[model samples]
Target: MNSTSFDLDPSYHILVTGGAGFIGSNLCEFLLNNGNSVTCLDNFATGKRENIAPLSSNSRFSLIEGDIRDLDTCQQACKDVDYVLHQAALGSVPRSINDPITSNDVNVSGFLNMLVAARDAKVKRFVYAASSSTYGDSKNMPKIEDIIGKPLSPYAITKYVNELYADIFNNTYGLETVGLRYFNVFGRKQDPNGAYAAVIPKFVLQLMEHTSPVINGDGSFSRDFTYIDNVIQMNIKAIVTDNKEAVNTVYNVAFGERTDLNQLVALLKEFLSEFDAKIADVNAKYGPTRQGDVPHSLASIDKAKKLLGYDPQFDIQKGLKQAVRWYWENLK
Candidate 1:
């Protein structure tokens, strides 16, 4: 919620890897605004310099142009840092399917590098960006942390591996770790132009241009679309929580609700229509279901609420309104 609500000290030095990406950049901004010394490490592979350009001017913000795949760079970034928010990873199942090697190189190997570096540096805590894709083929509704099905994609495997590694590091090396398995997160600065671009921004951009956005399935597929601020809240909670039981564990970082693709498109159009009524007429085209895609996903946030006191402030409609307005002003 607010800076005063967090347990983080103003003088603490924090390292946010992938700090130029959408979520990481947002985290950096939030932390720096709260009077924390924030260092950003990014390779610019999928991260954008424009995201952190404004933050660079802040006296409390520093940037390290490096890759997480390199242990030396990870160590350098972790140096003197009080906390490590490891958000760097190759996202998207299709992208990982196309290039599993590269994805493994970054998501798996790179993650290990960060863990080792954090262990060596003895950072106060290691908070990382896990994925909801870790649920894989589970038919379970309102997915729980303790019950997960087998991973279906290379991306999922990599993220699951991250949790396993985090557990080992905490037990063997005495490193405190918390993993937040983020759902489909969306918000400002999310790139709409890319093959692997997320659904919300991409569809918003398409609607803004009065073009048809393609749906991967018949539009029944649902996901717990989390807002960026909610994700930021989870990261803050993970780093600031004093509960011993909360540490060395994973929590589903989501809004704890599901929105089908059909509803998502309708909502986007409804919100975007306020800017340009023509967008309200734009419709989405359906296509065959995507590989490595699950039909529906929901999260049980009881654990986060009970352990970390996580309170997500934005829901789909509210978050979509803000996101649509942001896209209109910035990208339209």
Candidate 2:
């Protein structure tokens, strides 16, 4: 992935809380490549060690095997860190519904612990992985950051609570914070296995295996399907920006356009067919819509563009092509 030219100094020490997971691992790799000292903290609950294995060779990259649910572990991870990118949260609405208590314990309570630790450590900035699910139940076509509706699931509730706590920390404790509300982010390193695997990776794997991928709804349901590179740019921008007005706010990180599920599958098949034409023949099966899933999700990235100078390089087509190539080379 190409690096964005941000103002982050190479000498800064950074901590990535879920640095073994898909997005977190990618962030750690980017920071380390830019000549920064990176500390990764992960308990390996949902994160896989193999994702971050290559990073071990970098002398500036260190791993702290711990959980955020433990306040002491969070404190240790924040020690001597200049910035904290908090990405250690239990994702997936279905998983949250199945186990709300565990989800709360990790996403909500653990997030609070990280906030407390960062506040006490006096980190220069706290940038976290907030979700688009916080826009729940609202019928707005292009979701703006300020307006939100009732949360549809346990996962949404936890993410929304994160925003509230971040706000409180900034107001009451004076800790700098920025929340990036990411839309359906996908790219390389994202796991394609397990019940909660995201649709992009899961479908790519099924098609490569010559199996029909299932669509949760009539296939018209759409999303803003952001690429991982765009998300990385936002995180880096969040940490390095010197504009005081941008520090305490949440911004939407997305491609600024929507793509429906049917269109998404067609694009995937087209991209994968370059390697094996048989992938085009594999069809998608229809199923009942998932509970708590919104019919459509689109983000207005005007805030991020104006405040943080975010210029997303990859649209869905560009991102999907790269993602398909990675899965073809890695999975096959």
Off by over 4 Å in 2: none
> Which candidate leads in lDDT?
2
Model 2 alpha-carbon miss at residue 162, Å: 0.3
Q: What overall lDDT, based on C-alpha atoms, would model 2 receive against the true structure?
A: 0.96
What does candidate 2's lDDT look like per residue over 197-224, in tens digits?
9999999999999899999989999999
Q: Write the per-residue lDDT of candidate 1 for residues 1-332, one digit (tens) a residue.
A: 47777767888899999999999999999999899999999999999999999998899998999999989999999999999999999899999999999999999999999999999999999999999999998988899999999999999999999999999999999999999999999999999999999999999999999999999989999999999999998999898888899999999999999999999999999999999999889989999999999889999999999999999999999899988898899995
- Please give the RMSD to the true structure for each candidate, in Å: 0.8, 0.7
In terms of lDDT, the poorest run of 10 residues in model 1 is: 1-10
Residue 279 of model 2, lDDT score? 94
